[model samples]
Target: MNFGERLRFLRNELDYSLRKMADELDISFSALGKYERNEHQPDFETLKKIADYFDVSIDWLLGRTQEGYDHAIRIIDNAVEKMDPNSEVELYIPPAILNEMILKNIDESHLSLIPVYGAANGMLNLSESNIIQYEFKHNQDMPEESFFYIISPDDSMKGSNIVKDSKVLCRSLDIVDKKNLEEGKIYLVSYQNSLYIRRVFVNNQDQITLQAENVHFPPILIHNMSDINIIGQVQSVEFNPNEQK
Candidate 1:
C-alpha cells in the first residue's frame, strides 16, 4: 500500500482515530488529515514520530520496502496467521481441568463453558473458598496441581455485564501472550498477592489499566513490571438458575 493508504490501514487496524493520532503526535488533526489524504507530507521529524507511533520505519512509510524498518513484519505476519478474524478458534482444554471445574461448583449439571475474550479474562472462582485447581503436565516431570481463586475485593466492577459474585471461567493460556486483550471486556487478574476480576482499559505500550465493572471499585494501574498473572481469557458466562428468580 502507498503511504497514505498504509497509514490509514494501520491506524484503522489499531482502532486509532485521527484526533487521537494527532494528539499523540502533537500535531493538528487537519495536518494528520492531510497526510492521510495525500494532500501533504510530514517532515523528517514528524515522519519519525509517526513511524515510532506505529512502530514502523520511515522507509516502510514511504513505500520504499515491502516490510517495515522495525523488521517486526514477520511477527505481525505470524500473528495474522494465528488470529484469523474470519475463523473460529478452538482452545485445547484438558479433561482434568474440565472435571475440576464441575466439581468445584458442587453442581456437575450446572457446569458450562464460558468464552473469555481478553488476556486476563477467565473463569472466576466464586465458591466460599478457592477450590479451583491448576493441573500442569509436562515431559519427564510430575504434573503440578494447585488450587487458587480470584475475587473482586473492590466494587469497581459492580454493575454492567460483570457484577460482584459473578462466577467466571478462564482459559489457562490467555495470560501468556497478553496480546488479545479486548478493551471494555471483563478479566480475572492476579495482582499483588490477590486475585481480582475487572475490566481492562488499555492506554498504550501493552500496559493496561484495570477498571471495575461496578463503579464502586476504584481503578487499578497495571504496569508492565507488575507481577500480574492472567489465568484465562473469559469466553462466556454461566448463570446459575438458583441464583436467579
Candidate 2:
C-alpha cells in the first residue's frame, strides 16, 4: 500500500474522524485530506508528527515495511532478554551479520555493501589490509567509491564527539579537488607516513594547519601543503566497546 492508503488505513484503524485527526495534528482538514488522497505529500516534519501520533515507525508510515513500532520494540526486548550482563557484550556487529539474519531470504542484488576496516596499531596501508564488508544504504549525492571506514587512533578529537577506538566513515580526498577543502572541518590526513584526524585550516600561503580538538596536542603546521596527504574526510563515527566480562 502507498503512503495515502496507509494513512487512511491508520485513521480508520484508530476510529478517528478526519476533522478530529486534523485538529489533533494541528493541520488543516484539507491538508489531511490531500495526504489521504495522495494529492500532496506531507513534509518530513509532518510525517514525523504523524508517525509519533500513530505510535508507528516512519518506515511503516512510508510503506517501507509492514512491521510497525511494536515489532521493533519486540526485537529489542528479545535481544536484551538474551543478553548476559556478566559476559562480554559484542557492541558493534557489522551490518553483514544483520543481513545474514534478516536479509538472507532477500535478493542479494538489491543490497549495497561498503568496506569497513579494522583498527591497526600503527600506520595503516589501506591497499594492504583485508577489509570487512558491511551493508550500507548510500545517499544518492554521495560518491560511494570514495567511501571507506577507519578507527579513530586516539582521543584527540573527543571534544568534537569523536572518541578513541570508534569506527569512522570517511570519503577519500582522491576524488575531491584541493580547491574544495573546507576550513574547520575534520579530515583523515597522512603526514610523514602516520595517519591523523584533525580539523584543517588553509592559509593564504602554500601552508596548511592541522589543529587537534584537545588543547593538550598543539596545532601542527605544514610549511608546504604538498607534504600533507589528504586521505579522506571523516563523515560519521560509531562508538561501541566491549564492556568487562
Candidate 3:
C-alpha cells in the first residue's frame, strides 16, 4: 500500500477521527486529509511523529517493508551498528525514504534522468539503477536549457573533486563550437560514440585537448572539432549521499 493508504488504515485501526488525530498530531485537519489523499506528503519530522504515534517504523510508514515496525527497527539498528565510521561504501537507505526526503526539501520543479556512465572512448550506457532526480537551481544566472544528469564513471576526474559515482548536472550543448569553448572548464562530451566528463583545453593549432583531473590518465588530443560532440557543460556536482536522508 502507498503511504496515504497505510496512514488511513492505521487511523482506522486505531478508531480515531480525522479531527481527533489532527488535534493530537498538532496539525490541521485539512493537512491530515491532504496526507491521506496523497495530495501532499509529510516532512521528515511530521513523518517521525506519525510513525511514533502509530507505533510503526519509518520504513513501514513509507511502505518500503512489510515487516512489523519493531522488527524493522531492530534490523535497521543492527545494520547501522555494523557500519564503519570511515568506510567509503555508501550506507543503504530505501529509495522511498530518500525520494520523499528529496521531494520535501527541494523546489518542486526538477528533472529525473538516468545517469550515463563510461569512459571517453568506451561504449557509454545509462545506468539502470542509478537514476537521479535533480532540481536545477544552483546557478540562477545561467540561461535555461535542456539539462541532464550523469555519474562520473571512474576516478579520471578525481583530482578536480569530481569523484566516481558523483552526480553531475549538465546543460545540453548538442553542437560543438571550438570558438565558444572555454579552456580548463569541465564538460560532458561525446567522442567515438562514448560519453565523457573531462576538462577541455584549446590549443594554439585549434585542436581540442581533453584532460583528466588525475595525472595518471593521459590527455587526449583531437585535431578535428567535428570529432567531438559537446553534450553539455557540467553545472554542479552532488557528492553527498547523506543529503538524501
Candidate 4:
C-alpha cells in the first residue's frame, strides 16, 4: 500500500475516524482528508508524526520498505517461542504492554483466553460468556482465576473514556472484598436485580451513593447496603480496537 493507503488502513485498523486521527496528529481534518485522497501531502514533521502515531516506520509509511508495524511483534514472538518457560531468569511482560500488542492486531491464537460475560442483574449470573483474550496468563496481582470480562453496555461511564462494548476487567468480589470497597472506585453492581456501572461513595455502613459520571444519569442512594450487591471491582477497561470512532 502507498502512504495514504497505509495511513487509512492503520486508522481503520483501530477504527479511528479521520477527525479523531487528525486530532491525534494535531492536524486539521481537511488536511487529513486531503492526504488520504492524495490531493495534498503532509510536511516532513507531520509525516513523521503520522508514522509515529500509527507505530509504523517512516520508510514503511513512505512505501520505501514493506516492513510493517508488526515487524517488531514478529521478532518478539519468535524470541518468546525459543525461550525456555522454566528458565531461572523469568521474563515477565506487563499486561498493558501485552494489550498494546493485542491492539496492534496480534493473532488471537497467541492470547490467553478468559471467560467474557455481559452484565445482567445484580447477580450477573448470565449463562453466556466471551471473555478477554489478553497475552499474559494473568494480570500480576490479579490472577487469571480471580477476574473475568464483561462488556460495558453503554455510555454511562463514557466520562471515564470507557465507551460501550469495551471489555471491562472485573475482579471477583467476595464478602470480605465487598466490605473493604474503596471510595470513589467504579464497580459492577447489582441492585433491584439489574446491573450498573457507577462510581461508589461510602455513606455509612448501611448506606452508600452510586454516582454516574454522566450528568444525565442521576445519582442513586441506596439506604440499605444489603440491597446493593457488589459483584466485582473494575480493574481495567479496554476499548475494542475495532470499535467505530
Q: Pick the candidate with the highest TM-score.
A: 2
For model 2, how many clashes? 0
lDDT of 2 by residue, 1-245 (tens): 78998889778766899999999899999999999999999999999999888776677778897454334344445444444455343333344433232322233233334556655664444652435333343344554467777766677787777766677888878523446678889988888977788998878885688899898778888886678788888888755343225
The TM-score of predicted model 1 comes to 0.36
Off by over 4 Å in 1: 1-129, 132-156, 174-177, 240-243
Model 1: per-residue Cα lDDT over 1-245, one tens digit each: 67888778767765788998778779899988999899998899999988787666688788887533223333233333543355454333344433233212222222222222321334334342233322222112211112222332334454644444444444443364456666676666778755666677777666677776555567888667346776545544443323687
Ranking by TM-score: 2, 4, 3, 1
Q: CA lDDT of each candidate?
A: 0.54, 0.68, 0.67, 0.67
Candidate 2 off by > 4 Å: 1-111, 122-125, 130-135, 138-143, 175-178, 204-206, 240-245
Q: In terms of TM-score, which candidate is stronger, 2 or 4? A: 2
lDDT per residue (tens digit) for residues 1-245 in model 3: 89999888777765899999999899899999999999999999999999888666788788897555444354445444554445433434444433333322222223232233332333335443333332223333443346656667777888766776676767778656788887788888788976778899998998899988887788899999999988788877866332456
> Worst lDDT window (10 residues) for model 4?
126-135
The better-scoring model by TM-score among 2 and 3 is 2
Instruction: Tell me the tens digit of each residue's lDDT in model 4 across 1-245.
Output: 77788678778877889999888888999999988887887889988888778666677777787443464367356545644454332334455445455334454334443456654432344343322222243333545557777777776777776666777777777543346888889888888877788888877565688888887779898877678888888888765634658
lDDT computed for candidate 2: 0.68
